[model samples]
Target chain A: MAAGEGHRLHRLGLVVNMVGGLRNLIFPLIAIAFGTSTLDFGYLLLVGIAILFIGFTLFFSWLAWTRFRYIIGVEEIRIESGILNRNARSIPFERIQDVSIEQKLIPRLLGLGEVKFETGGGEGDEGTLAYVSTEEGERLRELVRDRKEGAVATPAPEIANNDDGTADIRRFEPEAEPLFAMDTQRIFTFGLFEFSLVIFAVLFGVAQQFEFILPFNLYDIGAWIGIVEDSGIDIDAISWGARIFGAMAALASLIAIGIATGLLRTFLREYGFRLDRTPKGFRRRRGLTTLTDVVMPAHRVQAAIVQTGFFRRRWGWHALKFVSLAQDSKEEGSHVVAPFAQRPEIDPIMKEAAITPETLDIGFRRLDWRWWFDQWALLLPFALLPIVGLLIFTDVGARAALILLLPVIAALFVWLSWRHCKKALDENQLYFREGWWSPKLTIAPQVKIQSIEISQGPIARLRGLAEMEFGIAGGALSIGGIPVGEANAIRQRLLDEIVKVDFADVNRG
Target chain B: MTDCAGFTPTAPLAIEEMDVNYKGFGAINCLVSAIQQRHISNMDEATETEELTRLHPDHVKVTRIVASLFMLVLIIPAIIAETAAYLNQESGPPNGVFIIPVLLIAAFFVLFMPWRRYIHRGFHMSADRIRIVRGYLFRSDTIVPFGRIQHIDVDQGPIQRRYDLATLTVHTAGNHNSTVSLPGLLHEDAIAMREEIRAHIKRDAI
Candidate 1:
């Protein structure tokens, strides 16, 4: 691990690259297999083409493996890659926000991991080492941490140094009590609430793509009916009660399948979910197949979000996430510290992040009443169009006019949302509580707020109401339908707090 | 003065001070009429105000030229359609009727709308923050504190360069409304503004 020397990835990366290449060729390989059964002389030509394709894939994978190299320097890490374009990227030690190690199913078995460097500059990982030995990844992470701390002029934490040129991987192990961990029972309870129909969609896609091997046409309803009759179940001769019972049985089976899929997905993703406080940050380790190890520093946590779904809220279950500059995943911008926890369980984690939890005595103020009326007025016309059309164009009688109930139901929802949406600004933090069914509470410190906007549309101006949108670093916090006076007061108050702090001092910790 | 819509523009009216007459309408209709009346009254308030600074006068001319170019895209196809219909003579309408309205609409958009938009947009800089107000139909007032600025950029397009105008954009760490741009400034003024804001921006703000 000499500085300024370029190192190639482990040779096992070639196997991983080849597997990725072959995965992309599956459709064409399947097509060729089907073609070989239909033609005689064409079979030899297809086989030759298939062999050439596999040879080319293997050649390219090997070439790519040979081309990729990374140089861990004293001040920066440089990566050189690309087959023809030849891309060289240099990331300084101070710019990197965090380092994570991820091991997918194959790499985990091979005792290899992918190291990702998050720069907090954009949407994706700034630098990555695709396949390296787990021990090497850990050593590289520690080296980068030491260099970054050195650049910041801060004393490095007490860890066994590698001054004698020996790798000490065990020095980075977690020794304190875990902040949060999910056992099998809690995971199963979480799975019950996460019922999904994704399995059915996957099954349908498989049937569509590979239906040529099936004996019957899958889409033909007549063929399905014929098969049912062949099984000695006459559809027209069945009793009404029996038909109702059969339909219920079908629905029950669908529910059962959905629950099974949810359980399988949850178990695979949250198998050994654990969160621990380490010297570097709050470290999270999870996943049965694709293990991910992420450490989010406490100072970088700009805001905290407590989320709960409709049923989960009823059962007193919540998830806590921290909004940081580094993204947790491609789709989620916040890191989930506790996927499933109760109010008492989440308090300590929030405390660790320096975010105050919502208390019972906090005064939360509601938005203007026009917030409800504005939504109702905007939606009622669209809802009335269909009901009015039914009443005027057709002779379906009064039953058709029952569609008018749609607007009433919509009005009820608008009222509920307006009632639930509230904001509370304490001495140091801003709390926004939104949503009726699946409520989300966002807590942002006043010093972290970047900008404040007070917007008024034509209708809002008439009602003397304004929407206040707060600009946070990695999250959105807005409260609409505030009276203009209050909106201005809040804006001034927040601005006064934002300008007083020196950001350099804030970043040092 | 009343325009084609029989609506008059007046001095800027605050919501509480205005008298909105809604004698016979239902609650929703009353709300709708109140908004319409306020919109019409405030239309002329786009004129100069005491605290805010209007964009350079040449901005109106630049906007007019750009709008006219966009109108060409619409007018060319419209003229072609009219000529083809006249040649066919069997199914199309009379020749001058269609072209007349289309040309009139294009003229209204190209000749008049730019000045209206130019009047409505204004920006003001205070000790610590910049406030921008724009759009007559959908008014938005955004304020960005100088301490929150991550970077400042002064950009000038080809047309803007000819007019000696530039746009100053300040970037913040916020995801929504992260970059606030104030266009239609003299090139030198934009640069000065950028430098001033840059001076206020502290290092490692995020």
Candidate 2:
């Protein structure tokens, strides 16, 4: 736990790396198991090859572990890695936006965690110290935070040593009231709303990948029918009512599987979800198996997005997210501060981020009426082409006319979206409300806008309307169908406000 | 159709004298009308003065050369395909039948389109910001404040160098529309613009 010295990762990381390498060979191992029956020369050769592969994996893991080292200097953290091709990356303390500690299932059992330093450069974590002791990770995070703030790198008082060398680190004491926390019942309800069919896709993939190991062909419907018939069911002579009931039962089970998958995934990801406001930043800790502790400073928040589905909105549930330069995960561009909350509950968290929620009395401007008409005009022809082709070329001529219903539905959707899409510019913030079914509200501060653009296509020019786009670091703020004059006025106003403030006072990303 | 000369007896007059008298008047009238029309259009242009500076005149030639090069890439393949089809067929249109239309279209694109593009592309500079206006059918006007510029780049290609032209690009922190490039500026102007923006960026650096 000394600064200005090189340190290696926990020794147990070699075991984790070896296990990870072996997991990649699982399919081939399974193939070998099924291919060989007798202990002949072929079996011996296969076994030898497998042993060699495992040996190589272990040797490489050990080599990598020995080669990797990190040094915490006064102004920067330098990481040296690679076996043959050496790479040394030094990240200045001021450039590091935040530090997060994550513990996967294996590492957690080994009392190790991965510390990631996010620089908000959009590429990814600038540096990561994998498989460090939990206490070491916490100490490193505190040291980086202190150095980033231009404070002396003093040891954090919270991480005290015990007489016996066992970690009794009090990670959470709940000194102040948490901004948001989800109980089991709330998570379950959220899981219900998140009903997913991804489990079916995963199961299908597994079945496809290992179909040869199955007793019968997985995709052959005749084989399944034979099995059913062999079990004393007369499929050919079954009544229509019984067939309908069987189909209903199958549908019900499919729904049940989907719901169960959603619940399982939600429980694994959102168990013990808590968000607390620390003096330094907002601390978010969650996950049942892979625990992640992230602290994002409030000033780095570029915008706030309040999202809800049609059903969730009806039931009064919304999710709050902060659009920061540091991403929460690979796929999520924003950090989810409140996974499930009501309006009143979300207001406090939004206030902490200095983003105001849409008020009832605030006037919102609707887009031009032509927005819907233009879309319908462009889409209706493509829709009619297929229907007309079916009507002319097929025997079901009159019935094909029923296909016109699709275009009707599309037109309705465009109309509804045009109705729902609205934008409001207040004295301090720009609010955009979009999506008809799943409404999302994005609130961005006026001064955070980096640039402005007003664009016009041929049609937009004819209509004397323009699309206005605002440039922010992390989030998107754009609205179309404003009159040309209004767009210019808005751009001038925003530019005036942007130039008035000295950027030295502002936080860049 | 009957000959019109037989029907002109009702309005016979001194055509040569009228033509001689009206020629001078018509020239003066056209000159006056052109000046009046130009004045009206100038008044209209003054109100919407978004594009303060146009791209260099030589950019039209550069664009034409580039477009012709691109057209040749496509034209060569098209000529080969048409020749192959003509030779493989027992009886069909002539060898140049398909290629003629392609050549005509390519000629239109290579000869005329660059001028349209040159007329549409322009940029305006203020003390605090730069506005770029581009595209003919799909016009876009982008304004980047100097205070927000993260960096500035002045780039020139071989052809651009021959024409003494360069492109100036300014990068901002935003993801969308982060880098706005204004091509076809005089090389000296582009470098001057980059230096000016760089100074502003340094002044505003945190």
Candidate 3:
């Protein structure tokens, strides 16, 4: 493996670019289709353009190939790129948080891996080696890891020119033990339960693409919705109230399709999900289509969040994500620790992250009941205003009955949310629990908190209520509609804990 | 100094005594205070690397004008429609009359925003962290530790460029509220702040 000098990405990187450029080629093909029949010899032009497109892809790929080279310096890793606009960046070894080695289909087929170096500093990956042989990727990761570890241990590193250099290789191999495994069957079930909001968008895009590509006009799902509305299911049938039956059916179908596709996606991405604990960090290997292996070091992870949908929570199923600098599988900035987890599974995982809320019987302070009223007031605009407007402006009939049901459901949602919300302080960690249907519990260490605050609105002030909010690494969390005294106490506690300054001394001024 | 080992307040200041002195509180004040609650307590003061710096007061004019221009741009269609409707009497009463007051209210916000920000928006950089306090009604004070800050950017809009002022945005890890923006600083100050912060981060690797 090339070590000292700057090295360019593998020649296969050009092929990777060509494969990526296929999407760009589609526009020309689309234009050709649109211009054809009207223009003479359009097919000939299209053929010529296809060749040109591939040539264009190759030319640009070559430019990118030549321009992009990374120099693994003794102290820092330097990446230089751009043809017309020359750009270069040097990320020091200490700054680099983690190195993730990923292999997509093409890369895997070619025995290559994409290495991304992350520096908790958020400007995205500090540096990325687009395509390298799997061995080279591992070697590079090991070399970087050594430098990073060595830098912390001693002021300077001598391992690069060690007597045998066997120490470097030996330490790379951590005693990894299998901690969690989500087999295909479990993943399938997990996927079915993992209903995402993205499905609506996916369906919309797919429907449009299908409409354009298909020779025959496909059934208009929108028309089906209209048909249901026109069916005139008895509005007077109060016992069997199905006023918004059509809308409900449409939504149910959408959810059904979402679950099905979600299942396929889950199977495709996490077919052989496995989690292992290594000396370095938590080693995770999953993905069927694009195999990914990422090491979530103990230090990089900011917090652990356990989230579950209303229905999933009932069946003791939850998804766990770690808020970290690494932009995991998606650009979520959240690494899904366990795609499908329950209280038992999550307890252990959270414990590993030092956020074990299981054994600790921390007393939680519930928000004032007036929080429900505030939620209702907030929900009124989306629920009641529309209903009132419809009732006042339009003829009140079957639609009115359905509109009335909206506020009722919204009220119940608000009530449930109000009941479920609680904030607890467990010595070093802050446990924030919210949601009724789709509950989310966030565990943030108090020392990690950057700042603390207490605020109140006119209404809240009048009611002797306030909100206590605290900021950690990833984001901020608030405990709203709490008693003013409680909020102040929480605020003072957080300030004292986070900042070394005496809250009493500071407040005296 | 009290050992703050437990997650409990050691301060003995009467709870009621700590109530916010909401003097001259307006919409902007409430807004800033609300947003501020997510970060630092009202008692927290700015901590700068050198010394705390407030935004240039002239920046208010730049932001106000820019915002008012945008509001005016939105109001143009309504004004045009109203005039067109007025010319054509057969179209009955002007359809865009209601839009005037709405746009005016929006314009009020545009005017109010910059004034409040000019008064309250300030930033500080310490040896280990950079602090920013913003919002007039909803005061928020955020401190980004050197280790946590991902990157810093100095941006200048046309008005800002003309005024020789720039906005500095410091990004931290993990997306949410990642970018803390401090607008209305001398362009040189913005650049110097960026460099200084970058240098500190580099020096203090941890």
Candidate 4:
């Protein structure tokens, strides 16, 4: 009754959210420490303050839960919320792109879900109905979807199930076909091949915080050598014995364990990675603890980026992602279409998105070599100065001088990347290929380009080259070192082609 | 495709001269006086005064004033730091530091930046497209098609209002260059321009 003539979140909303808030408090608690050995009145006072802070937070959450409500009218959903300063917004069903029902671990355990309305406006995810019963969430989503169907002109079949209807519907979403999915075995395989570096980072952070926790002081190499000398234990390579061998064996197992932990994390994150064809588009349901259901509508996808890491390339495996409007992606403006896919397996997925071989047939054009070597020459001082300084100042100069090879390797890699970095433009699609170690091939439709910027610095002016940047609705993809003439020509041609788009293409992807 | 060494185009930014002859990089004849002359389209050579409209000339004066204010702000920090150091001799840097003069001399060149920007800055509003050009050392020419414009805003600052000037910003559907700002237009002209474009968009939508 206090929440007006609209539905409130599930009864356990306050309890669930309070638990989540308490979990977040763990991070801050580490920063605010009390010396247990010196416990007194001050400690009691600090404890009391902490309790007050937590109590205040819970009180606010309770107020927010009770006040927040949304009513489903005929054409619009009116959401009213706020504990202190009230906020109200009415979103028409037609404007609601998709009602994304998310079931993270906590919500799933409580039989609750959060339904996010990704409205077409650039302002974040337009609205969210948090902590609804999972069954009620399904019902609410169905209601909104039916309303949307009735709101928009139904028989516009040519733009078949396009999420945004921003561009030409080259390919329609196939009828709810169970497309590609990862099995538990292959999920583990993908996890095995993938490496999560977060574990080492977390361990290193902990080691830094609690020096006593570390087996040895990592920074004190001189002290270590002194100990080794005093102990009459020679672990030196030149005069090695069984002790050196033991150290090597320990180091090897440590590396193995590190890799094993990384594999475990990858498994947990992508435990049930599955991609299925939904009525609107593709719904990807993945994760072990916090299950995420990301729906990528056909038209909303701006561009396709296929990336293959050095190790993965050897195995003919690549990861592909699509740039979209919503903030559903872990990576900004992009959602992973396939985490680990073979080249052959990716071909069909690309086809489903309407990025075909013919569209990519435009011969790749390499950037001018001056853009490569000129930057290298300017960057050489910054790269070499530290090594030169070390040689001049530090006793470890002779050892650090070996780092000179790193720049050489980096320059060699840059040369290879220069060879690989190329752009191709056709009537409808634009493709760019970059990277030597991990090649990324990005292909975006011409209609998706928001604007074209042809710019040149004084150096570029002298060379008759420019930086050509193509802006999409979500993320921008740019190919530098384009000849100024070619860039302008491409711009004009793109503009002319853009004018010829049919009425439906007026929207933004 | 195999060897890139021999690959070269005749003209860099002037590709396909037939289509973009009247309208592009080469259209600017002089670095300094070029702002006075409007680019004439080669296609409509018979009608010598081409289609593209130039921005109001008062724009230069306004921009120059803004640049001077910006330069003052930039120089103030260096001046204050040097003054403070000179006042506190014991804790100060090694004496006889004429850093203020040295910084001013180097920073003086920045005063010319606004002039160059003014010379390059231009906007043309036609039936189908609105083009805004800005920058001097690094130039960016943005062409926003009428069909793509999501919204149009006409805004005026106190300084601009005193001079009866307003800036028109056209926001397009594309996220990139979603809003292109064209400053230094007569206030009435800006409103009229927005209404004209708005009417055309509505007409085309149906």
Query: What is the C-alpha lDDT profile of model 3 across B91-175, one tens digit per residue?
Result: 5677667577867777576865665555555566666566665543344445555555555555666678788887777655534
Clashing pairs in 4: A484-B12, A484-B13, A485-B12, A485-B13
Stretches off by above 4 angstroms in model 1 are: A1-174, A208-223, A327-331, A502-508, B1-50, B82-95, B203-206
Question: Could you give candidate 4's per-residue lDDT for residues B1-206 as a string of tens digits?
Answer: 11110111111212232134333344343432232111111111111111334467677567666666666765677677777778878674645355657555544545344434555566667666776766655667677766555555666665576677878876544456766888889888987887676555544543
lDDT minimum window of 10 residues, candidate 1 chain A? A500-509
Instruction: Report the lDDT of model 1 for residue B68.
Output: 88
* DockQ of candidate 1 relative to the true structure: 0.18
Q: Against the correct fold, how does model 1 do in TM-score? A: 0.71
Per-residue lDDT of model 1, residues A1-509, tens digit only: 24335988878877777677778777887787786777777778777877787789778877887777888866667676766544445555655667899999888888889999865533343678999999989998999898766656664554566877665665656566799999999999989988999988999999989999987999899899999999998989999999999999999999998998889899899889999877677899999999999988787788999999998898899999998765555456689999989999999999998889988778998888796798689878888988889899999889987887888888888888998898898889999998989999999988887788777776787776778888776778888898665676777787778777634334344
* Candidate 2: clashing residue pairs, number: 0
- List, in order, the clash count of every candidate structure: 0, 0, 20, 4
- Candidate 3 differs from the real structure by a C-alpha RMSD in angstroms, to one decimal, of 11.7
Superposed by TM-score, candidate 4 places the C-alpha of residue A92 at a distance from the truth, in angstroms, of: 15
Pairs of colliding residues, candidate 1: none
Report the C-alpha lDDT of model 3 over A309-355, residue by residue, as the tens digit: 97887789888887753534445566887879777877787777666
TM-score of 4: 0.65
Tell me how far the alpha carbon of residue B177 in candidate 4 is from the true structure, in angstroms, after superposition: 2.6
lDDT for each residue of candidate 2 in A293-362, tens digit (9 for 90 to 100): 9888787787899999999999999999998755545555679999889999999899988788879777
Please estimate how well model 1 matches the true structure, expressed as its whole-model Cα lDDT: 0.75
Tell the DockQ for candidate 4: 0.16
- Candidate 4 C-alpha lDDT tens digits along A1-509: 25368888887766677778778777666555444425556566557767887798778887888878887876567676766444444555544657889988888888999888765443354578888999888998899878755644454454445468545444444435456777788776776666555676888788789988666786898877878888886556444567688789998877777678767877777777877755466688878888988798776777888999878788888887877754455346778878888877777887777666333457888989888877787789998998899888889957897989978987897799899998888767888899977899998888766667766666665566668777676777878887665666677788777655522343423
lDDT of 1 at B172: 63
Off by over 4 Å in 4: A1-177, A212-218, A222-244, A327-331, A357-361, A384-407, A502-509, B1-53, B68-111, B173-175
Tell me what fraction of the real C-alpha contacts between chains A and B each candidate also makes. 0.35, 0.33, 0.17, 0.27
